[model samples]
Target chain A: MSDNQKKLIEMIVGMQSPEAIELTKVMLEEGADPNTILDICRKAMDSVGQKFEAGEYFVPELILAGDMLERISELVKPLLKEGGGGQKKTHGKVLIGTVAGDLHDIGKNIVTFMLDVNGFEVKDIGIDVPVATFIKEIQDFQPAVVGLSGFLTLAYDAMKETVEAIKTAGLRDNMKIMIGGGQVDQVICDYTGADGFGLNAMHAVKFCKEWFGVKE
Target chain B: MNTATQPTSNNELYAERVQRLNDAIALRQPDRVPIIMNSLFWHTRHAGLSFRDAMYDYDGLSAATRKALDELQPDAYVLPHPIMALGPTMDIMGYRQLKWPGHDGVSNDVPFQYLDKEYMKADEYADYIFDPTGFMLHKYLPRIATAFEPLAKLPNFPSLYYTRIIHSTRSFANPDLVNAFQTLQKAGEEMGRMLGKTVQFIDDMAALGYPLAESATALSPYDLFADYFRGSKGIMLDMFMRKDLLLEAMDKAAKLIPLQAIPAAKHSRSKGVFIPLHWPGDGLMSPDQFKTFYWPPLRKVVMTLIENGLTPIMFWEGGCTSRLEHIMDIPPGKCVYFFERTDIFKAKEVLGKLVCLRGNVPGTVMSAGNPDDIKAYCKKLIEVAGKGGGFIMDGGSGIPDESKDENVQAMFDATREYGGYA
Candidate 1:
């Protein structure tokens, strides 16, 4: 790897504020491709996540790192698209949101960030997202995965409703459904007829990878 | 004189044995599995006493607890009550006077009373600088005094008056807030005397569950402020627009908790505090929001409690196991996380050695299923979580008001029958 590439990786992994953005700029200035910078940053975040899973780091550190990585990614967005890489093929597209009536998005955001870092084209619908929005996003994005997040006990009903709606739309067979949150359990997922249930952010990524047969 | 197994008349023996349970918890071991009873309300109901009656009637409580020990033979006892009395802000402001339908203890609805239609529409309520006393008297007190009359009579009536007058007089002057909080600290110290007596009495009564010490409950400053102080939408908007104000409020609220918790820890048999996780659940905030707003205060609260010689036993409502690995950041062994729907096996693998793991039995199973089913579930949980010494077996969540007696009996029976270090 080039010195700038290595430095970009370190900035993303270390989650160093200002430094991450500055380093990304420096890498771009040094003739590094924006796509290469994005790839390296993604790898760095994945590395940070692995450390998090291995108990080497905690959530604050992971979030800090994720934030820094995002900062660097935002800087490179315009440059990457100019190189015909912005609309490049992704691992798979995902339509993700927290279910209706439940505004919680922490787990969903973590999952989205991880997915983005891992190369999945994610259309994040945000929290308190209506079921129709998920349907519309799926139709528009034609994503392989539709992930639902609900952090409330009451939102389980909405998740079930979303799944039923997807089935009613005759799109169930075309996409995989996954649900997660504090109130979500295997029982709820089974009852809701979701394809899988992710117990946490890391597990969600693992679930998506397996569901799509991604080689990561 | 070797009456270790024999029932003793003196309550002091019970206290001594209970102290040992605390020591064991500190070391992460007990003579047997320590069963922290599901809920104090249920315990009181099982003893055929009102929640209010149980709070003040020490001898009656002692007798009822003795019967429970004789029957259940648990490894420890977890009491139900916030160790410290109300803080000046909560007490004096009449926030403590708020009530809910089902429970006898103070409810978590104090902040909601301050929510006027105007407050919600203000768009800047988040940045609306908190004039503690002004917010209380003009906004919260009338609601408390009128809507929650029953709560006003419970205790700490003086603090409510102080809270009203101070807030009404000055927008943010809280000179007495610290002193009011100190009063709770004083009360906690006095509680140690009662706790010592209760422990001795219970230890002498039977060879039951270990008598463990724990706070009544704990709350993250984020939850305390957002759910109780600023309401959800207001807090969220504030985070975006008035980040500085929100941080200041959080910092002020955070400062009070540790100071109050220290005395409570001193009185606790286990030197532990049970911080109940309320928000950051499925419907409350997104995982990103949790990382931004919830985790910081939670981390701060957990760190503060740990730093102050108190262990935080977090009772996480909803399924928090998804984020369990992240929670492992707080100093290990300084906290024991109790969960509602978290993956028990995963928790064991991830946080087992680092912090004590309590709970996993489905509350529904205990409430609706038969004894055999309860036994089967408990046996499985024990098989998975009981392999290590740091695990405390409990229902997946708390035992709700509707839990069946036979099912509860089966849970205890299964533990006694199948749970041992053989």
Candidate 2:
């Protein structure tokens, strides 16, 4: 990596604003391919996710780092498309969203970042995503996995409904469903008929890896 | 030796009662393993009162607590607090009125107004820590007034002066601030005496345990100072820049707490002091941040309580079994952890030998379900957590006010039926 690419990686890791964008510009000027820059950003974020899992970092830090990565990805996206590197194969596709009636997004956001780093093409549908959105996204993305998050007791039902809707739509066999959040439990997961349940962010990653039959 | 025939004296009875509870804890063989529903606001509400009423009325408070105890009938009575009047008042004055989104009297929206836009900006921090009384009177009080317009018409208008003075000391000039803080400390000592006396009266009559005091784990001391004293945005900057000052402030806060807590514990005649392990869970602070920012002060507080002859009951808010091993270092049996989302089996497997374990019942089952559900759930919890003796039964978090009284009764009934010495 060139000095600018190194600096861009640091900026992204440190979640420093303007510094990240400026470093991205410098890397681009240094003849760094936009695809290469995206790769660097992804690597930097993967390290952040690892640190988070290892207990060296926290939610705010993850959020900050994820934001920086998102900004860098936005900057490099056009370039990746122009370079025809946009169609590069991802490990798998994931459709992740917090269930309805739950506005909390921090947990969902962390899972999204972790999946993103693990080479999963994560499509985060943000907070309070209705069941219909999950159905539509699964139909459109046809992602290998569907992850639902809810932090409230009320939202657990929404999670169950979402799962039932997916199954009713005959998508259960094709898609792997995972559920988590504060109000979730093994019983809830079984009742909801989700394929798996993750107790925390680290567990979510492990669940995904196992579900996809990927080592590590 | 008319021990069998004559009625037992209060002291003898109280001691025997406490001993029985401790024996259960020690032997892991509590007859109907004691389950304490450590609810903050709900206990008060269940007594047919409001937050303001519970804070001030000792008799009313004691009565409500007694009622709950009679209703639940756990093997032991763990009194987390007869009344935690301070933080809630500050929360109401600082942010919005407190609300209980769930049972367990968990107070939400502990708000703080920011003194500076950037908390870590040392240059601007002084401006952020100004006279809170005037601010509360001018800005927050009016808001409270409007919110409680009907209540405002009542006599003896409530004032936020105390909370302002308590929170505003960081902004004062050195010598004045020091002198002011000393005077405040003396005043607080006096207030502690009064609070203690009130608590002691309750203790004498009810024979209850101590009040459990916990903060959300997401709140580091720095977070508390920033969120409760400074604004969120400002505190974020403060964490990066004025890190030293933030640490110093936390140390100071930590030191001050024990002074009042000791007296309160004495007053309540409590054997245990409950401190919540909130932030070490998955989505909040990492274990690293917990070790760095949270663990030290918490250890200090826990150690102080133990040294002063009080047991430390740690309420692990979300899943904290992952970090229970780290907590084992804090002097065993001096602590009893109440878990919410943690793996109880793993906790029992790991920390069971080290400290007493309480809780793991899902609040949802108690709040929304029937007695049979509660009975079945308690039976399962007892089978797992009740194995060798250091386990107590409780709602996973707290019993919501809306929870069916019959469900609460069923929890106690199940404990009696299944949680025996055998």
Candidate 3:
């Protein structure tokens, strides 16, 4: 990587928003490949994920880093389209949303952002999503992984209902289903009939990556 | 030596309950480990009241809460007042912070959901710091509540000293501003009625021989800023970008909270100040960030409360395992450290001698698991954390709304069976 590109990654990881955005603009002005720059941003996010897992970083750092990546991607997108490299490759597709009866979306939003930055095509159907909407979106999006998120205990019944609906529709076998957010455990997972459960955003990412057979 | 044998009078029962809780708070063994039922919506549900009815009808709320307390019969119970239900008060003021049941397309059974957003922008810190009262009157209140929107048009009132007072007073005559003031008056009256009901409920519950766990609540200044003004994302970013301004705002809030919390606590039936911690847990912010930004201002508020002889009951909401050591700086036996998800065993080991430990039976068990699950967990909590006293049996985050009726009964039964002291 060029020195500017490396510095851009460092700034992004450090959560220096203006410095990272300015550096991205400078790198683009210097005629760096937009695809290479995007890849470098992903590389920085990988380091950020590692730091978070290692306890060196926390939610604030992750949020700031994600924000920087988003701003940097906005700067790089037009350039990619002009260079005829608009269609990007993703590891796999992941569909995530907060289940019905639960309006909480912070955890789901964080997981969605993490998945997007980690090179997955993430479709966030938004919060308080009905089970029928999930089924409709799944048929249309045809994702490899589906994540159900809810923070309230009442959402356990909602999750079970959704999971059962998914099974009745014969859509369970094709995709790996994972449930998360708010006190999810083996009992909840079994009750919801999800394949597995994740305690945090990184766990959700790891499950998606593992199911897709992608090694980080 | 316990009230289970039937006290001669309700006053004796009340005194016994008070002593039991005080002994636990002082890190001494009472007759038994006091059990407090901290369930919110579960109370309404147990009484067969819809969430909407509980919020709107004060009589229904009081009856429902009374039914639950009479059936459960714990040492202490969180008053199921309409303060949280926001019944008529929500519509009176046009409050914009939360979406509640029976309003704005929400179903009658749903709980109120707080809509978290930055009510105050990043650039408005200077405005807030210079005059928080003026800032609230001018900017913050207007943004959060529609009724106060016209107050934004009124000139800064602090400048209205001499002839300026006459000039400023005229602005209140504006039809819109007049309407706003009248609406505020109605809101105040509604709040008065709600509080009256709450006081009556407390008295009725106390008459029936139950004590309130907390008389008043104080919000951590950091949480006040994070929840109402800056929002979680905005405040988190502020820690990195505008650390000094954030610190200044929190320092200002430290002084403001005790002004209300102390006086309210003094007038109430209990001496505990319930402070529910919204942020500053292990995964949300690093230990260093928590130490630098979150803890100091909070510690200031806590210390002030302790100095005033009121015990501060801090409900640490999330997993704060890393924050255990940092929080031990408080004076011993002067506070209750209630953990929602923190490792209570570790908390007991670290803070047992210093502070009373309450809670951490998983809400998942209370909600989904059977009575056996609750009994075994409570048995273990009573044996371990309840050893030598200073532990109160409670759910990790109170009993969940969907918690099984049998499981809640099991929790109460387990406390009596396993929580006695020699």
Candidate 4:
């Protein structure tokens, strides 16, 4: 990475949004490749994840890093697409949402950020989404993995119904289905008929990478 | 007021109920484990009233609650009043987070759903630390409450130093501003009257034979911010990026928040202060995060309540299986943990005779499961959690009205059949 690129990584990981934006503008102005910028930011997220595991970082830091990276992505998307790379959906594709009757989006939002930073093309369907929406999104996105999220147990039935609908709709055979959120366990995963479960955002990332055969 | 399972007098039933609960909390085998019916909102529906009716009519609410309690006859009651069921207030306030009874977006049949939103932004931590009351009035309130949107444009509270008279008089020069202030003035009077009624209802319930389970509830510093100020996603990010600020904010809240409830607690005949813990567990955080962000201040709050001659009953909404080892380090018998999901047998092994233990039954099962299932679940729970003493079997969050009426009766039946000291 160039010095400016390295500094950009530092600012993003450190959660300095104003400086990170300025540095991105400066780099693009000097003809720096947008792909390299995204690559460095991804590495910064990986570091943030590591620190989170080691207890040096926490939820706030993860969120701020996600926010800064998102801001930076907004800044460079036009330039990258003009250079024939912005529309690129690389790494992996995953579609996630909170099940019906469940309006909680915190778990879904965190997973969306984790996957996005790791280069996964994530489509968050938001909260209280009906089962039909999941089937429709799977057809449109054709993602490799499907994640069902809900915070309360009332969504247990919704998760099960959605997973069942996906199967009946013939979308289950092609995708690796996953269930997540606060109340899920091995039993709930089976109850929802999901292929696997994620207890936290980090676990969700690992699950996606392993399923798609992507390495760190 | 005379009923079965009593000595044919209201006074005797009251004394026996208090004595039964006190015995269980002390780890002594009571006549049986006392049951606390936490089905507050359910009574409104069971009474054939729209959830909105309970919101506005205190007399109807009190009568409905009393009738339900008489039928079930649980040893204690939790928030069995209209305060929490009041959805009309949310409608008037234009709270974006709540979908309430009789509201345009939601049906009147179902209980209200409170969706979490990020009311406090990332940068407002400094403002909160500096001047909490002023910041909340002008800065935070306007954001969360849509009806209070005009308050954002009002002058800073301290800046309006014209005189004492101006403080009471809200004189908005512009006609639109005048309209806004009038709306607020009327809402304030109505909300105050509603709150007064709920408080009075609590006192009335105490005057009756039923012992109030919890008169006042406050969150730990972490949850107060997580649930109210920042949503779950917001607080987690704050933990990593603004570690110092998060810790400082928790400490400030821990010191200040409990003081607000002291006067109420001192005057009431409640068992003690109650805490409805929301965050800090269920794999949302790491063990290190639990130690650093959650445990200490919570322990301090428990100790503070105890020092004031008030006990702390912490209802772990989502269980704390992993943190039990650390939680065990607190002075035993000084704490009461009403858990929702930790395995009872495992908790018995870990917290043996330390803190009193209560609950693991999810309200979901009772709402749908057959009476036999309720009996079997309680039988197993009593075998494990009720070995020597210190166990109170309760539904996870609450017993819903949709909960099978037989299964609701079967809870106490199972307790009487299987739960015994000797």
Candidate 5:
């Protein structure tokens, strides 16, 4: 890796947004490969994700890092398209939403952004989504994985109903379903009839990666 | 022993329940651990009223609450479920912060939802810090409630003085601003009626031998900004983007919150202030970040309440296991650390000696599991956390609104059966 690329990754990981944005512009001006720069940005995001998993960072850090990545991507996207690279390749398709009776979206939004950056084509159907909406989105998107999110105790009931609806609609076999947010345990997962449960956004990403047979 | 043989008068029972709770708060052993039925809509469910009915019909809400409390007599009650009876008042003012059961297309059975948004824009921090009241009247209120939208057309009221005051009074004559004040008047009347029912409920509960848990409510200054103004996304970015302004705004709130809370607490029946925490849990911010951005202003609010001789019952909503050590820096026996998702055992180990612990029977068990599961959980809670006193038996986030009556009964039964101290 070149010196500027290394500096770029370090700056992004450190949450130095202005410096990272400046260096990205300088690298592009210096005739660096746009794909190479995008690759370094992904590596930085990966490191940020690792720090979060290791408990060294938390939501604020993740949000700051996400904001920085967006700015850098805006800078690099045109160059990549000019080079005929045609945007980053989406590894797999994932459909996610907060289930009925749940209005929380902070956890779901974080998961959506993380999956998007990790090369997954994610469809976020928004909060308080009905079982019919989930079924309709699953048929249209034909996603490899479906994630049900809820932050209330009542959401568990809704989740169980949503998962059962997916089964009744014959969409269960084609996709793996995961449930997340607010006091979810093995008991809840079984109650919801989900294939697995995620404790955080990274866990959700890991579920998608594993299901799609994508190696890190 | 003779007390059990006689029919206890309501006066005697009131004093007994009050003593039990006070002893628990002061880190003293009561006869047994005390149970606080912190359920909001569950009482309505038990009374066969939907949450919509509970929110809209104050008389029905009061009757339902009385019925539930009469059946499951707790040591204390967190009366009138803060927002349950204010549906009409919110509707009058077009309150935009929360979407309730019947008014906003939300299902009648579900709890209210808070809409997190940048009600106060990022660039408006200096304005808020400069004059919070002015900004609140001119900017924040108008933005959040449609009834107050016309208030935005009025000039800054602080600048109006002497000749300016004489001229500024004319702004009030604007038809739109006049309509806004009428709207506020209508909302105030509705609120007065709701509060009348609330006061009546409190009086009835006291007469029937139950005490209200908290006298007044306050918010963490950081939470004030996060929930009502900057929002989760806005405040998270401000930590890095504008630390100084955020700190100043929180400092301002720190000074203002205690002013309202302390006086209200002093005039009320109980000496506790309910502060339901919305942020500053483990996943939202790291320990270091919490120590830096979240704790100082909150500690100020807490300490001020403590200095005023009021107990601050903070209901930590999410898992704040990492921040417990930081929170432990408070005066012993002066506060209650009520938790929702944090491990009760670990909290007891850490804060057992310092402050009273309330809560943490998971809502999942209350809503989904059977009576046996609840009894087992409450038995363990009472056995361990209730070991040397300073523990109050309650649900993780109060009793879940959809909790089964049988499961709730098991909680009360288990506490009485296994929670004896002597």
Candidate 6:
């Protein structure tokens, strides 16, 4: 990363959305490598995630960072066709959601943002997602991993039912299933028949990497 | 279910249990460890009644509750707040946040789900802090319930004050506003009657020897703001972007709650005030955030209640691993802290001498683990948390509404088997 590129990374990490957006546009207009820009955005997001974990930042910052990246992606995608640098070829695709009857999406949203920055193609089926949608998305998206997110105890039965439905439909063989939520534990994982549980969003990145045997 | 123990005619058994529980709260060793449960609509489901039944049939539901409590005979049980049980009025109010059984899309067995959306807008923090009651009357109520929608049209306060003084009839001249006031009055009367009956039922239960664990309930100011008002996404952003305003709102809420709660909880059986603490756990915020946002105002509330001779049962929702040390700031034997996901044993170790530790074996174990597993789990909770007479046996969270009878029965059975202090 060049001096200007490093400056852009710091701006993104600082959550200076307008400054970062303007810098990316200027850097690109002056012909900075799109790969470096993409790389720096990823690193900046990582910094935001770390701050969130450390309690220096919070949900609003995470939401803002996600928005910044989305805006930056729109700007950088057109210029990176030759370098193929705008979209890091997804290491793996993952389908994720908070299961039926659960309205909490904070944890799931954070994981989705984390996965996006870490270069995984994530399909968030959104909160209160039913089993049918999970199956449809699994078949449609062909994700390597499936994440069931729930914050309530009732979602336990829903998760177990969804996992069982997938097994009955013969889709379980194709994807690795993971459950993430505040209440989920090893016992909950076994009860829901999911392969593992993610303690937090960053833990999710480590889980995906461990599953695919890849390095970020 | 064993519906056999009714506390002998002199009410000795009931007194023994109440004394036992109160003793534990006072940091004195009782005959044995007492179990205090939130119950959390589990009893409604346990008796084969739907959550809908609890809302509609007070007599039948109270009978069901009486029957269930007679069987398990917890040292004492936390009664459900009757305000949430008024099905028709709540539905008619078009309360956007709560999904009740039968009337809402929710199934019969499921309890009411509190859906947190943005009721208080991000821009309204100043209004909320400056005049909360005024804001709640003219600004907040309209946004929260459809029944109060007409009030939203009332000009902002001071303007409305002047209008009320100048053209008193103008307030009622708007036919829609008149209709709204009538709806509000009628609904208030009906709700008051229903809530009155519920309070009567609780008194009757107390007369029958089963005292309530928490007669008064207060939502922590932080949660009141984060949950019902700004929501996690909104308030959290405010925390980063507008820290002072958020804290101001929280402090105002903390001071205002006692006005609604303390006077109303004057029932003879009302002992401890219940404050459910959410969003302070390690999962939601870090230690520093918790110290800054949650502890100070809530602690002040607890101390005030204590000075006024009320025990405060502070239930820690989610987990409290990050903020356990801060929990120790309270005076010894001054309060009871019910933990959901916090390590109860570690809590006992940390704040055992300071506050009584109640709870929390994971609620899932009842349905997911075997009866023996629950017994073992309860035994472990008793062994670790029951030391020095500061622990009560109960679910980490409330019992899941779907937990089986045998699993829940194990809670009492394990208490008898392994929880005896004598």
Query: Candidates' DockQ values?
Result: 0.05, 0.20, 0.71, 0.27, 0.66, 0.43
lDDT score, candidate 6: 0.79
Best by the TM-score measure: 3
Docking class of 4: acceptable
Mark the regions of model 3 whose C-alpha exceeds 4 Å error after superposition. A82-87, B1-6
CA lDDT scores, all candidates in order: 0.63, 0.63, 0.87, 0.76, 0.88, 0.79
Residues A42-125 of candidate 6: C-alpha lDDT, one tens digit per residue:
888878877876768755567668867888988988887664965554678988999987888888988998888877888888
Residue-level lDDT tens digits of model 3 in B1-422: 24466678888888888998999999999889898988778888888988888888888888888888888888888766735657798799998998888888889998777887888898888888899999998888899888989988888877778888877778878999999999999999988898888888899889989899898889888899899999888898898888899999889999999999999999989999999998967788898999988899999999999999899999998788999999889888899999988999988999999999999888878877899989899988988999999998899988888889999999999888878886
Candidate 5, residues A104-169: lDDT per residue as tens digits?
Answer: 998898998888877898899999999999999999989989999998777889999999999999
Compared with the true structure, what per-residue lDDT tens digits does model 5 show for residues B56-90?
99999888888888888888988874568888889
Task: Sort all candidates by DockQ, best to worst.
Answer: 3, 5, 6, 4, 2, 1
> For model 4, what is the error of residue B232's alpha carbon versus the real structure, in angstroms, after optimal superposition?
3.1
**How do all the candidates rank in terms of lDDT, highest first?**
5, 3, 6, 4, 1, 2
RMSD of 6: 3.4
lDDT of 1 by residue, B162-205 (tens): 56755554422344444434554555565665666566763554
**TM-score of predicted structure 5, chain A:** 0.88
Give the alpha carbon lDDT tens digit for every residue of A154-216 in model 1.
Answer: 466678899999999888996888888755556567767898887667777787788778895
Q: Total clashing residue pairs per candidate?
A: 40, 20, 0, 10, 0, 2
**Is model 5 an incorrect, acceptable, medium or high docking prediction?**
medium
Return the TM-scores of chain A for each candidate in numbered order: 0.87, 0.84, 0.92, 0.87, 0.88, 0.83
The reply for model 1, stretches above 4 Å from the true place, is A14-18, A27-36, A39-62, A77-87, A130-133, A136-140, A152-158, A182-185, A200-202, B1-258, B264-272, B275-358, B362-373, B380-393, B397-422
Residue A30 displacement in candidate 1 (angstroms): 6.3
| lDDT by residue for model 2 (B245-355), tens | 666666655665566666656654456665655455755655665666667767777777779877666767777766766766766566677788788888888878777
TM-score of 1: 0.53
Q: By summed lDDT, which 10 consecutive residues of candidate 4 chain A come out lowest?
A: A80-89
Indicate whether candidate 4 or candidate 5 has the larger TM-score.
5
Model 3, DockQ value? Answer: 0.71
